[model samples]
Target: MGAVVLIATLDTKGPEVAYLRDRLASLGVDTFVIDSGILGEPVDITPDISHGELARRGGMTLDELQHAGTRGRAVEIMRTLVTDLVREKFALGEVVGGISVGGVGSVMGAAAIQVLPVGVPKIVVAPTASGHHEFAPYVGTKDVMVVHSIVDILGLNPISTTVFDNVAAAMLGMLRAGHPLGPPSADTRYVATTMLGNTTHAVEAMKARLAELGYETVVFHSNGVGGPAMEELAAAGQFVGVIDYTTNEITDPLTGGIHNGGPNRLRVVGELGLPQVVVPGCIDFSVFAAGQIPSALAGRPVYDHNPEYALVRTPEDEMRQIGRIFADRLNSATGPVRVVVPTRGLSIPSTPDGPFWNPAADAAFLEEVRANIRPDIPVETIDLHINDPELGRHVAELFSTILDSTRPKEALA
Candidate 1:
């Protein structure tokens, strides 16, 4: 592990930032602080890289930004610079971990998410972490950690001091427990899988079965972040095959759910020539924040998913659009593919006699997919629900067969 990157608007929180940096130093973790404040003068510690370097790297000048007389321009340039600098440092193995201390609506927190990759130790200390619901714009699919400061980051007070000490410790601990990504193993290729709470059994079965097939299973939750991370990494050639058993993110936008992973959800893996076995695991319903005022999904069937999120049934019309999206993306595949539809159910509550059960909608959804899918691509219907333990085994068998077929003649029996 290298120096922990500390970022702050040093012009305002210079003394407080110094305390944070020194606190981590006391714990034996070296600190590299980035200055992002444009309005005031930085004090005490010299910035390794200043706001001038950032603006220049962003294809602009600090003078030009000043001449433009807009703080927004400064914010934009600093974000671009920080993102570029952080990524460069990470590639050079200079950043082992990172922390950004910012006030409400600071672009610094959002930039932290942009710069850091999935597993790197990244933390953002901000007031928004205390219950801010508008999260995806800031976090996206990154694995950055966040801590609520409970107070604005100005001159250090008891609460601010306490928050700073706790955050420093957390960052130090994360760096001490270091993690570094290894080169992809050639002995066993990666198999990416997706799972929701509704499909946990299927994922467990798939993981064990794929292990026996000599393929490592990488499961991504179909949450807002996980789906995007899996797809992007797949395009980067991280996985040899994908058992995408949970495609619920596709319908999230159609039904106004917070878990909507961007629209480019299924576009990457196909373009990368990765073999895949897709499933309609839990596309039947959309999830909404429970207890809070729900999205304006009038007349749609809704059920309490948990205390935090509510589940709502997808209309046949929206399901049809999702079907077309599936076909359109899969049609571009340069490798083998499969789409599995569990005939009895799509989710736990979508099965017959369940709360969200509506056979008509399910039939409409499946029929559209079956009809629109490329003729060469096979779409199979299983007689079980998506969560049924056997469905996992069934999908695993199909995926293993795909892997076997792709093997060279000399590598096969």
Candidate 2:
């Protein structure tokens, strides 16, 4: 195992971090400390890479970084250098699992750890870890583990010590557990699937078919975080093909919904040149958690998905916009691809006479997709709902054909 890199602002989190280093040292695990702080008086514990060094590495000096206007920039610079430094060290087998303690003003440390590779046993202990909305961004698509300190990390008390001890043990546990530290292995090829609650039947059906065809299926919920993670894995060459069944995540960004999967959702799969079967699953509604629906949409009809979640119908205009975005993305694909629409419905609730049904809006989206997509990119419409068994079967068959066509084979024997 490479050394456990202790990350923190030695100027502020120095005492607690030193205590942690000493504790892990007692346990016979090698440790290295990196100080990302910009300004502070020196502490008794010297860091392997002091804050001063980090500032210089970030193209700033100590005095310059102390200014109010430059502190945020300095932090960002440090994040860049630190990420590169840690990644380099990891390639050389100098760093492995890591731990950091944060309270307030600890954004830099958290940012640094976030850059570490997934499955590296990285952990961040912060008071905000429990309910902070920022948690999702901090660990986007990465498997970085966060532990809620439940108490401020300002001083080492009973709670802090117990928390630190647990973190140390956890990090060591993961390191010794022989976790992956670099590029993923390609022992088995997998298919990536993006699904939503409304598109569950389709995904389940496709998954079963894909398994029978000897390909692994990795399903992602097309919610806020799932879409990003699935896409990130796809970009990393984690899948042989993508089943783009849930186009709902893109609607969030277009309509200001909380589940905005960012602007790069469908674009990643297309750019990868991976074979895919795209469907307009759940694109008819924009989902939001309880109490988060925008004021402008207050008058619009919504489906009370549950006490904690809801969805608002997408108007015809918005459907057309989503279609253009979808087609623009698919047009960039270098691999085999096809767009299929379930004419009867996009979701269970959006069926012909269902509460969310609106053929005018659906037809608008479909027409836009056909108009904007490349002439060579086929667009097919079936007289079935998205969740219908017939539609699922068609999608599965199409994906199977694409997967086989995309598979690399020997030219001649």
Q: Model 2, which residues run further than 4 Å from truth?
A: 68-70, 181-187, 408-413
> Evaluated with TM-score, which candidate comes out highest?
2
Can you write out model 1's per-residue Cα lDDT over 1-413, one digit (the tens) per residue? 57878787787767878888988888888888887876666776677777777667767677775565577866766666677787888889888888877774355646754567656787777776766546554566666777777887777799988988998888877766766455577776889999989899978988888888788898999976788889877865688889888988888877668778777887778777888999987888888777543547767777787788888888788888888887887888888999889888888887667877887888888888888888999998878888988889888989999988998979886
Candidate 1 TM-score, C-alpha based: 0.90
RMSD of candidate 2 to the true fold? 2.2
Write candidate 2's Cα lDDT for 1-413 as tens digits: 57988877777778888889988988888998987766785465788987677667667776766663766676677667677777778779888777766764455556666666667777888887877546664466667788888887777899989988988888777877757645545666688888887888878888887777767788888887787788777877777788888878889887788778887878888788888889989988888878888888877668888898899999899999999998998888888888899888788788656788899999999999989999999999998889876676678788888777766676212
Model 1 poorest ten-residue lDDT run: 104-113
lDDT over C-alpha atoms for residue 372 of model 2: 96
Model 2's alpha-carbon lDDT is 0.80
